[model samples]
Target: MTPGGRASTAAPAEATATTITFFGGKGGVGKTTMAAASAIGLADAGWRTLVVSTDPAHSLGDAFGTELTDRPRELSENLWAAEPDAEAAVRRRVAQVTEDARSTLPREVMPAVQRHLAHAAATPGMAESALADLLMDAMERVPGEWDLLVVDSAPTGHLLRLINLPELLGPWVEGLVRQRERVASADSLVAGMVGSQERDSADDDPLLARLRERRGKLERAAERLRAEACVRLVLLPRRMVLAETERAADQLSEAGFRLGPVVLNQIPERPDPRVVEAVWRRFEPQGVLELPLAAEEPVGIERLRPLAR
Candidate 1:
């Protein structure tokens, strides 16, 4: 055990395909530090690792002592890091939707569609949805480009919403597809009755096709998260942090997410053993990896590597 307590030396689990490990907790709990360190450890262990920060307020770049963009940048021989631009992602999604609407809807309806899209772009959770879409793209690159993908997610509430997004939106998209199918069916019947030669099939309708494709993507994303991803919450040993962590763990468990070992960060020297024991007992069955308080902030690859080990 290290001076802090017991430090877990085991690297992240090896996978035949790309496996994702997300480090998340309440704000200011050092989630980014743990995630960066874990990615570095994976890279040192011969796994090609990519660490991405999904938090709108990203500190992953700061942790690496370098700036990062939406695209991945190499930090070491086998490690890369990125802080995705949430605003840009939201704009891209809005533009895509606008283009799709233009192609499928009547010109008279375009104004209304554009207005709705504009409002949606500013609504709550829009950024999270956009970020989730970008994450899905990264997940698709998987074993071919990276052996492991470590995510430094937003604070607990936002992270939980992002995790459950696909499920929440999937059914809504499916309903839209069904509604479109019904409208198409009615149109086709009218065309048949009127002896019109220009009858459109539901399968060939651009709008319905787009909706189906979107629904399929949401389903696949959700499945990959449940099957190939694990969440490791990072928290301090304080009472409030511990209570929040417990609630977050329960929320994750209820959502059918796989929980990895919880990281107990910044354990003080000569701490009360009872507090540590209480944390252990509270998070029983799930291993607790302890990290001692560092003399200085663990920034840069060299400084972070020790914690990784």
Candidate 2:
């Protein structure tokens, strides 16, 4: 879809069904620009749209030539923008989990639990989970505050994992909750034998409750993506980008997300037919869309007009 408010020469019919669009590919493929431009186009079409950046190194503001924050800021009529703070999101999630655990675990052991949680929050997957949370939040607000939502995703790996999280983490979370329940049962048995006061029952375990809550959120997010969202892989004509896009497509297919179309951004004036053919043969996307190389850098909304259509 053209990001700029103009009709795309590629696909017109498909645009009507897409309310949430994810622009993702290898880094430097101009996915952020395309996402921002698409949001502009959607808004210009009279659809209230919010374009959000899940990339930790956000460039949506750079594309629009404006500063942005974690909160949604109005860019123009019917268009808004946001960049969720990944680090802060991670910290907040960890804090919630820790607080819930503190209600169950002994006070003396809470300090060590906090330390372990801090380390766990530093892992790579945590950032992706935080971004997933932001994406889910945006999707849940659809048709309420905005008619359309556009996501400028992180580089290929993170984006793929973020989309695949619910499937991968569902069982793992269930297993953790089960193990915690077993431990709680054993602790209760020991307290009874020792005539010590039993702290609480597993029925009221806060950590287990939190785990179930998180799992439920992820399940709903996965359902929203599968049922409502369309994923578009953006790429340049370079060999590396083509190969990466192919891999991304395969992963998306495996994860059960419907692939929308392949967007070829920044096409040169003298395009290579060979490069185009190679992508068509190997990428095999449902549809293909192209954006011409701009005469100058596409910075502001005016410069992005040609692409929007």
Candidate 3:
């Protein structure tokens, strides 16, 4: 709605490449299912699309019935999909960083820092940063190449972190990368543990420079994407799911994020009077996954084809 930005829809509108939407919410809310269908639909309607799953437990591969990897794999003709490996990505990031540090830092301090990263990677927020790096890479290398970049996100904690994280941590990571370079040069601006001239002169500065530059690029990826990104949430009709949605909306608002459409997945489909009592009976227990209800399955392009129209 800004000069050339995407407009929010009160109802579904024509699809355009400028819009990048995310399907997210509670674990069992059919996010991956909906996301896959939507991407397939967009592709069928003539837009080139990519669907990336940020979840540690990825299922986009299963949803598409095709083998996938960190790299984009073609599904049919126009749809491309990937499931970013959060843990493996973290290890790759560390490998690149430590390899650069091996020649820069004093032999004693470098090993200690490497060990610290090993333990830190086992924690929660560490993996998210690595995923953020992937997000940055995607946006820069292929901007304007795809009509849509849809994400099949993880559960609440990860979904919240995925979009808002880069902006919050970008400066801190940049500062740390800068500090490492300064120490390696023996300037020891903050950590005066070495002689001024004896700093690790053999260290690589470009690697740290690239990391810092990458962080800056990531800091803007979300907002830049937001010019078209809509954080659409899917939810069950149950009280717990709806209540959780409210809390998520509030928290994301605090981080400058807004929720788009709330997809009511697993709702009942056309019913007959003969099965009236039976339908409610089935849904009452299953809550959202009953057979009589509209089972949110991937329909390839038949269902999603209209989303772009």
Candidate 4:
């Protein structure tokens, strides 16, 4: 890889196994299409690829033209795809948090909180949090199942907010947990010194327990995302998307991630002089502009192959 587009003598392979997270500034930016094709390309190139859509819209199935359940289904030998059931996902997250909270909260409090969580879980962070949990679960559950995990992400702000969860909430969680732990320890020490015979342990510290659990989960998630090439931008070769992509690139770089590459999902095959191309496009013909206009779905992997690479 060289700035001059000339392959260096010491350059590595043309393609490396990298985690590609697809994001768009807007909904109709073809994030799903680029993600699907990228996954197919990676798989076909002899890399283990898992494509998971965090978008509630769940267009990964439509892109593949196959029945995709909430669980990961084998789209090919090396490729797997999944669209999480957001309802179930929210429930699962809320349940996990509630269960941990129940250890400390009054029994009646959980039921009330659980009812409220149903609607609150429908909010922006809720879905992303659930998806984050699913992502953490995947990394833990199947360590080596995928060499590359391609995340088909939601729209710009939401996706950025989602990925920025750990950094945004980390200090707050740490502070709250630390404060709770200190309070609990002090209360216990005071009780212990005052001759109260309550044998409360760390297990009994619900706030500390929840804090630790949540901290661990978020930390692990952040680690996984920050550890690997977490996100890959899939853009339209249009002006707005390119600007958004640049901003996203800056933010992602700031957030401490190894960005794989920037991919323009769909573009005019012809190099229209009026159209501004990405800096990387050095007078080369771009991808199809009317690609999405085609009625046919996917045209199978063979046809989509051109766009994938």
Candidate 5:
């Protein structure tokens, strides 16, 4: 424990290879505060850290006492921050996919394709999928630029769904690709038997290639999320919060995600050690961290540095 409250040791020097950390929990559990503080901590310790918020109702900027755009902006010497506009990203994806279809598919097939894209934009998991796409893209663009990535995710349910996206959508996209392949093969066979016009090159089949590409992206995202990231749950020291953490832990474990340390945030000045221990034991995290409730709201680098420690 440090001066203000319990603290974790600085991340080992060897752990500086573009790691991703996710901080998530129920709403109002100080998720943004803990994530921002942790990012600042990592940055202060000499890592190039980029912290981004995936929550639609963004508050990361408020936590930092600064406005953030979709592009990351410097928050300090080593820390940068951004709040991705998920809806905007989804809209862009929809337009891009539709445009690709329009350019490649037959004219008569475009109206139906447009309708399908419209429907997909409203699909249950589309937003989460789009968010995941943004995350993966960020990772790809950060090879030598960033050493640490931290995400202050949406509330537990939504964030978990985002993490599970590849598992949920990968097979669906694969099925679509498989079905398209079967249709294309049958069409070729028919054209051959009837001695019709020669079929175009396989590389010219845009829809099939697009489907395969989507599947590949989803699979890669899912594998990276499971294999290369650390997930931490932030919570208050309330029974309801404890119960929620247990449920979230089970869900994450079942989805093949390993839970890292749990941050017990906003502890009272004279917090009861027994109560904290009891609640922490329920989650059985690798470690438990305690953060004192701030006398004033934590905003800006100065106020946040101590909490980060």
Candidate 6:
């Protein structure tokens, strides 16, 4: 698909099939600019679109010359943009998980539980998990408030982790649910032996309920990502960038995501045809969409339009 052109219709249809397109690459690859330009193109085509930045160091706002928050801000007709605060997202997730534990666990153990949770909040993958949850929320808004969602993700590594969260965490949540079920079963058995009738059913157990809810959400997110989302890696013509993009494409494909066209941004005026040919050869069956280096920086919607074209 060329910038704002209709996304590939090859994806599996859902009851509300809102397409999610992601743009990602190494730092300085102009993915943010590409993402903003793409969103503008979609809006011009009459698709109600919301473009979001999941990168910690957000530049989507700069691209549009507007300040943005986690809430969507209208950029133009049919186009909205937002940059989610990664730190706030992580804190909110920690608070929610802590609240859930507080409601389920005994008061005597609450302090230790909180401590453990605090440590987990500081763990390496916590931020990515929170960001993935935020992305899932955006996905759930499809065809209701917007017809399309565009994500300007972080650098390659973080974006990969964010995209892989559903696949990785779904099974972990399922295991928690099973463990809770076993504990509830044992509790029921003990209560029966003692002739006590205060045991709660598995469905009514707070922890089990929470785990099941999380598992269901993750499962839905995974299905949408694997079946309805397309990831397009934006890259420059440099050798290092090309290498990273190649690896990213392979990883995304192996993770069951549909790889869209690789976007080659900022092509020089006297570009080497050989390098372009090499890129096409490397990514056969996946189109290579090129954007020429702008005479001036494409800062706002009007300047970005020609690049989108």
The TM-score of candidate 1 is: 0.88
lDDT of 3 by residue, 1-309 (tens): 111123445324543435666777888777887888778766676666788887778888877666789988887766889987778889998887787777556688986988987888887767877877776666554435665678887455654565665766777776777676655555544334543444342244656666677666766776665565666666665666666866775666565554565565665554343433432343343232222234355444454443323
Per residue, candidate 5 scores C-alpha lDDT tens digits across 22-129 of 898889888888889999998887777889998878999999999998999997887899998888888998998887778656799988988988999987578877
* lDDT scores of the candidates, listed in order: 0.82, 0.81, 0.65, 0.66, 0.78, 0.81
What tens-digit string does per-residue lDDT give for candidate 4 at 1-309? Answer: 222234546646444433445544456767787778878877787767778887777878888877787788887777888987877988887777787777667797877887877778879768767776776666664336666677786555654564577778889988988787777778789888998965465668766776778777777666666665445566665766666677876776686776655555455555443444452552233232233333444545565677775
Best by TM-score: 1
lDDT of model 3, residue 177: 78
Error in Å for residue 25 of model 5 = 0.4
Order the candidates by lDDT, highest first — what do you get?
1, 2, 6, 5, 4, 3
Q: Which wins on lDDT, candidate 1 or candidate 2? A: 1
The digit string of per-residue lDDT tens for model 6 on 1-309 reads 222334646533552243898898888888899899999988887778899998878889999888999999998988999998878888998888788788777889989988988898887678877887788899899756888899996555665665576667777877887888787788889999999985775656777787777777877877777878888888887777788788988888887878888888889988777777778888768888988887888998888887777
Question: Clash pairs of candidate 3?
Answer: 15-308, 268-293
- 1-309 per-residue lDDT for model 1 (tens digits): 111112426433343323888898988788999999999988887777889998888899999999999989988888999998989999999998888788767899999998999999997678878887888888887655776789996555665665676678778887898898888888888888998865576656877887787667777877887888889999888888898899999988777678988999988896678778888998779899999988899999999999999
C-alpha lDDT of candidate 5 relative to the true structure = 0.78
Question: What TM-score goes with each of the models?
Answer: 0.88, 0.85, 0.73, 0.78, 0.85, 0.88
The whole-model C-alpha lDDT of candidate 2 against the native structure comes to: 0.81
Clashes of 4: 1
Instruction: Give lDDT for model 4.
Output: 0.66
Q: How far is candidate 5 from the true structure (C-alpha RMSD, Å)?
A: 5.3
Q: What value does the lDDT take at residue 8 in candidate 3?
A: 41
Best by lDDT: 1
TM-score of 4: 0.78
**Alpha-carbon error at 212 in model 6, in Å?**
1.2
Total clashes in model 1, counting residue pairs 3 or more apart in sequence or in different chains: 0
